[model samples]
Target: MTAPAEPPRFVVMGPSGAGKSVVGAALAERLAERFPGLRFVDADDLHPASNVEKMRAGIALDDHDRMPWLALVGGELAAGADGRVVACSALKRSYRDAIRAACPDAVFVELVVPAGELGDRVVRRPGHFMPASLVASQLGALEPLDGDERGIRIENTGPVDGVVTRVIAALDAGW
Candidate 1:
């Protein structure tokens, strides 16, 4: 993990079924527990209406639809909330780039889960606009972390507590 010059923004990113939300939430809680002043933002809350509609109807979003969403999420990153963890399905490198453009200091934590497990997760989750079928497209768009970046790329194959603990350790190590 590369230590940031500052308490850089972080996006807990991956495909739809990669436990981004679950792990992001856990990480946020952990951060809050350790540093009461820390703030955590849920990036999904910034998605545009049309993009939500598209995903709700099982239609995959193109880069065009995602650009504005990226910008919005990035805007939040620019706020520079210390120990913040934003949950976003940052499926492409360009999408990651867009968010980074807004807050160049931020680092990414690539949450990873096997395809088969992801399918199971999508099936089990409820009330979310994202459809299980859309997982394939999201996976298709993913750019692997290449194990080269200075952040956690967790297996996301464990329980939420364990996952969160790993992230906390990674962050402590300044990933």
Candidate 2:
């Protein structure tokens, strides 16, 4: 028999400079067309002022600063339509775990770029509090996806369509 369809709980995650937003938007469009019932939620808008303050000051946030925000994102995921894309910077395993604790079927897609590319994007891109300098701190905080049961890593190094195609291929591969 054909396998049971994959459960739908999609999260796009990675470092700030990794282009999660772009891919998530593309994914959202694709899913909305294909599944139509899918919903897309960008996690950036949910960031609390505290996170904003920390990032504004160029201070890397610790998990303590992330718990409430994580919970809020978690709630959003739990409450989402069965087919949905959650665009978030879920950098660490613990954080992703927190999300899964709320919705066990969640799938994480890590949008990644090389450090140099990340820096270039951050510097060239206009009007974002996450400075290029924070790349190091963010890299420091990122846990490799290898150890996680629910992670898929995709490089966000080229055009949006190309990256989205790669992501879609990865998703098709079932991580």
Which ten contiguous residues of candidate 1 have the minimum total lDDT? Answer: 1-10
TM-score to native of every candidate shown: 0.89, 0.89
lDDT of 2 at 10: 79
lDDT of 1 by residue, 134-156 (tens): 98898888887655554568789
Residue-level lDDT tens digits of model 2 in 1-175: 1122653677899887788777897887876666656778888788898898889899888889888888888888777444668898888888988888887878888887888788888888788878888888888889867654676788787688888788777777765
Score each candidate by Cα lDDT: 0.79, 0.79
Stretches of candidate 2 exceeding 4 Å from the true structure = 1-7
In model 1, what lDDT does residue 16 have? 84
Q: What C-alpha lDDT, on a 0 to 100 scale, does residue 102 get in candidate 2?
A: 83
